[model samples]
Target: MFRVDIREMLVEAQPQMIITNDNLNARVDAQVYLKVRADEDNVKASVYNVANYKLQIVNLARTTLRNIIGTLTLKSANSERGRINEELRHTLLSETASWGIEILRTELKEIDPPEDVQITMNKVVKAENEKVAAVDFATATETQADGQRRAEIKKAEGTKQARILEAEGQALAIQLVNEAAEKYFIGNAQVLRKLEAVERALVQNAKVVIPADTQLINVIGELAGVAPIPLVPKAAASPPDRK
Candidate 1:
């Protein structure tokens, strides 16, 4: 009795073609796993075509790959390898069904563009990466500049607030001093101010001149609680020498 092993088998092929979208030549290596159908009708066809089925399926797979890839640009074909493999497998299964073959799995192993195209693609990728990096760097710089600007603004505001608070404190102190003087010294505030001035002047220097009509002892006595020392008036000078 003749027996056929309907177990799945692995088939691999490399196809090279020009893409219709860009007229760019490309190559792709693919692999497919398939098995023969075990039904009596399909087995009969397999018996008749199985010898040539492998070659037919390989040729069909190559042609389908070319047709599908030819319709797509090199970029799309490279990026959508899974889709291409699935499409190729489906197309091959439809045609190979007459040979009682069932496609179990399909995969594209490698896709290669022309050397010039590869170089151009690499340049494109590099340029895109550089553009993204430049954008990120510019954004970061702007953020840092904004932070610095805000910090400077905050510092300036803080300085202004501090100066305003200090000025307010000084004004309040002056107001309080004036109020105290008005309340406690009554109309003699001017006399009290003069006494303060004299006190300051004495602290700065040892010698002081007293006005002729002023009572130094009274002023000193009021501030220091000390006994006053009387001053002697000078004798009148003889009438100016004869004219």
Candidate 2:
């Protein structure tokens, strides 16, 4: 008995090609129909010679079974894209050089994800992104606030230092001026000398001498220094410059 439905898929496919260096070695073809709905697995294995191309229906049976099982598993996995790879790899190995059929390539088509799951995942991912953004904003705000507080504290410290330094300078200046004023008013020997001088001036060749005191002497000396000087004329401008 012979079958052609599985074989024609390879034959009729566009740009179809097959290679069989080791896959069609009939030594390893034991129970090739396992887990498959195909009815004939023990065909004579030489039917491909009848077609003059050595690609009979039975020769490509193993490759067909591989493709069918791979497709079923891929569909059952909801086309999650992992089992699809395993199925394809297994097909290449199982039918390589054995079934005279080899898959050229595999590509994905459309996917139909569950609506509820998609919505839930999308919301969760969006919330996660939003949480990250909020954390960054809070961190930035805290940093700015910290910097402002430090600046204010530094300004206050500088003002306090300046006030303290000014007060210290004022205190030093007041202490010096107070000491100088006290020295000027108390026990100055120059007062006695000024009293003698005032007494000598007041006598004017008369026999009147007042009792000399230090305080009175200071008064007389201050008055004498502040008084204006009197002018004396020269001798007639030397007779009008002698013509």
Total clashes for model 1? 0
Q: Give candidate 1's root-mean-square deviation (CA, Å).
A: 7.5
**TM-scores for every predicted model:** 0.78, 0.40
Return the lDDT, model 1, position 203. 94
Can you write out model 2's per-residue Cα lDDT over 6-69, one digit (the tens) per residue? 3423222122222222222111121222211133431222234234222333344445434443
TM-score of model number 2: 0.40
- Name the candidate that leads on lDDT: 1
Count the clashes in each prediction.
Answer: 0, 8
